[model samples]
Target chain A: MDFVQLKKNCKKDASAFPGYRLALLGDCATQHLAMALKGAAYEEGIALSVFDADYNQLDAQTLDPSSELYEGKPQGVVLCLCTEKLYEAFTLSSDRAGFADATFRKIKGYWDRINAHLSVSILQFTFVERDDRVFGNYALKEETSFYYQVKKLNLLIAEGTRLVKNVYPVDVDSLERRLGRDKFSDPKLYAIAKMPFSLEALPLVAFETVGIVKALMGRFKKCVVLDLDNTLWGGVIGDDGMEGIQIGELGTGHAFTELQRWLKELKNRGIILCVCSKNNENTAKEPFEKHPEMILRLDDISLFVANWHDKASNIRYIQKTINIGMDSIVFLDDNPFERNLVKQTVEGITVPDLPEDPADYLPYLQSLNLFETTSYSENDRDRTKQYQAEIGRILLEQSFESFDDYLKGLDMVAEAKSFDPFHYPRIAQLTQRSNQFNLRTVRYTEAEIEKIAGDERYLTLYFTLKDKFGDHGLISVVILEKRERELFVHEWLMSCRVLKRGMEEFIVNKMIETAKEYGYASVVGEYIKTPKNAMVETIYAKLGFTDRGDHTFVADCATFQPNKTFIKE
Target chain B: MERNEILEKLNEIFRDVFDDDSITVTEETTSSDIEDWDSLTHITLISEVEDEFDIKFAMKEVVGMKNVGEMVDIIEREA
Candidate 1:
């Protein structure tokens, strides 16, 4: 999008969409950046209200407790430290050898002070790489050169931000590298006004920033729904046979191989991969099973649906089986007809316009950054196996005559315990990513999760499930705030991968048991409606709680009977 | 390019940047005559004009251009 179009988006009505409060602090002029951010967010169906701080007020706003930033009560803060200002500071510094370390310390101090005052996510922009060309090629050898220092500072920001739980480093340096420095920055504009980014680059920078904000708001892609034909490989599997499909080191085949490698890495990082094809199941399975050139195998896919059905309906079925929101699924297809059909039929699905050349596929998709996430843990790597196990349970249920007998045959086991430090990452991840099974849909960061675990008034429970198939690690999270006579369910969310199992029944039983043991009179639960959370609209009623006219439900602990489940807790 | 032609193009750009279709700029028009044409919009307006005429306004021209007539002179000379 251009500057004019984005500026026009600022006037569009965004009241119906979800709103987010953000404070923007920068060392340079930020008025245009704020406008671009709000305008870009509007296109994504988000009403972003930006509190644009004055120029060069990063220290003042963060250091002072009574600053306007604190008064605005923003949920997130965006810090933009431009390369121009950093270069000036570097040139003026007396100790050039220690510049990077000193700069990083000051940046970390800002994060420490702001976090001490307010528990909000910080979107820290990495410095755009600039060189004075003072040492030319030898700049790489000289540690004191601005080029070397800036590169070192970027690395410091990346490693240091990871140590802070809530600071997310937005890689503006990488963006500049991709767009080329000439297009990304206009020196004349910088000289005229303190604007670090050119008018053309503001929209893109705003886009990347808003992507993180959206992910923080629990709106991010969870699964990639892929096509099998010309999209994944070179030719049709049904016609080309396993040997004829191009997906190896020969010519354009390497492109498909690279794309597959990227997709496999994403799958390893916990994004579920699924197959939806129009060819017969055997035809699609032949390449994945027997083709030596294929980078993606049957083991990588969580769900495979290869039938001659319309891709839109097939994607919906895949979504239902996987139990993720339609918005969280990104459908990739080379055929424009199929892409248009899915885009028009599905309400919130993301279907990118795949380029005609297969060689351009991976780069174009990477540029879109479809799968932006806020948290990751070791448990994420096991997500594919968990979903694969869910498919196994589903198939086993079909062979059984009765539902209860099928659940019993699985020999399910579960554990519900208070939140511990070891399981905090996975627990917090569920609260942010879970949508369909989420009650109240309250997203929390790891820092907030740690805070809640330590507070005495809040009771936290994390649930894990395992069966003969595999283990679902830390699948559910519950936070209950203690009232004088009752325990109010502050937050409750469960992974959809464990939906059909008796996990909810087991968890509800544990909640009531815990309440009675703590000498509480009653347990109360609530369901707040979101567009993607309709699956749990009547969860409080279904779990046998008294509807209290409001969106809340209550059960007297003394009179409550425990829910029966096949799982042995 | 003709002087009148440059003025016509500048009028279109001024309408677009100011987000006011009723805006019309002649040789005598200046920043004070426009309600929303402040320092920020002036930058946007100059950028828009530069892109429209396929030219780059020097830093001096960006800040020192006094009126619509002066902007038209730069466009005519650059285009």
Candidate 2:
């Protein structure tokens, strides 16, 4: 999205957009950045309100809590403090190392000030090196060189933000390096308008900022649903019959093998992989099951929906089976018609325009950056097994006469434990990403988790469920806020990956048990309604709690009994 | 292409870039004339015109061109 176009789109009445106030704080000319971002936000389908600070007023706006930024109360704040200004100060001052340390302190001070005042997330740009060959290549070797100083400064900013709550760095120097200094900076334009970056680099900056914004909004592709045939390999599975399809480390097959390798690695990172192919079910299974060089096996796929049905319906089936929103999926098919059809039918399913040549597929997908995320943990690796086990649990349900019988047969063991640092990363991730099974959705960072765990007023319970088939690692979290003799369920959320295993009943039993252990009379559960979590809307009522309206339910420990489950702690 | 023909093409490109179908360009037209035409859009406009006309803009032409007429002159001369 270009600035002129954004300026035009900004003219449109944005009253209908779910408005998000974004505070853009900077020292140099950033009106264009703000304007360009408005257009970029429009492109990302985000309704943005840009609250930009005045010329060279970075310190004033951040340091002073009474500034317009705080008054506006924006959802996100982007700091674009110009490092070029440091050159003037550095050139005049003799204490180079001291200057660097002071600059680092000042930058961190701004971050601390923002953290002090607001609960909003910060997007800060790290310093880009301004080349001064006065020290030559030796300048890079010495700490006093502007080159070495900038590197140290950027490193300090990065290291400081690591594991710190809510602060994220956007590397402007990396962008400058990638685009090359000449392309990234137009001296003529900078002299004319005080615009630090050239107009060409504006779109890149805008998109990166928007990407982070979208991820924060919990609106990014969660799964990459793939299509078989010419997409995954060099020929049709129906025609090639597993033997003839080209997919190996050799010859023309190298490209397809490379594609499969990328997909497999993505699956390892917990991006759910589902297959929607038009080939016969058996034919589709043959490649995954029998092909010697196939990188993705049947086990790698969460759901394989292969039929003569339209691609869109298969995609819908995958969504229904996995129980994730359409926006969270990216469907890849080499055929343009199928891609377009799926894109049209399912409003938000990301269908990338694949190139005619299979070699170009990986590069194109990389450019899309379809699966950007804020954090990851060891528990992410267990995601594939968790989803795959859901299919098993669903299949086993058919043989059992009752839901209770299904639960009894699974030998489900629920390991009730408190929030441990080892499991805290995954615990925090669940609070952020688990939308469907979430009730009273309250997102938290690791720091907040630590505080909540240590607080006497709060009881944090995490559960890891293991059935006869596999272990669901840390799938459920319950936060109870103690109120005198009573307890309030602050957050109640479980992973859909562990659904239909009588986990809800088991969780309630544990909550009631915990309440009794803590000498509380009754424990209340909240069922806050979000569009994605309707599946769990009646959970509290179903578990024998009285619905007191407004999504609140209460149950007394006197009447509660531990629900029978094959799962044991 | 005649200057009028070049202008017509430029107007179409403008409409596409701005996502407004009602846009038209004349010799006196400047970035200020269109609500969406600013520094960001100016680069986009120049790139699109370059793509459409199969030519590259000199840095001088990119910054120096003031209106649709000057753009047409450069495009015509280059083409």
Candidate maximizing lDDT: 1
Across residues A18-79, which tens digit of lDDT does each residue of candidate 1 receive?
99999999999999999999999998999999999998999899988999999899999999
Tens digit of per-residue lDDT, candidate 2, span A219-240: 8776889898889988887776
Per-model TM-score, in order, reads 0.80, 0.72
In candidate 2 the C-alpha lDDT for residue A33 amounts to: 87
DockQ result, candidate 2 = 0.19
Task: Grade the docking of candidate 2.
Answer: incorrect
Chain A of model 2 scored by TM-score = 0.75
Error of 1 at A256 (Å): 1.0
Residue pairs clashing in model 2 are: A4-B41, A222-A328, A411-A566, A412-A566, A412-A567, A413-A567, A413-A568
Worst 10 contiguous positions by lDDT, candidate 1 chain A: A243-252
Q: Which stretches of candidate 1 lie over 4 Å from their true place?
A: A398-401, A408-468, A472-569
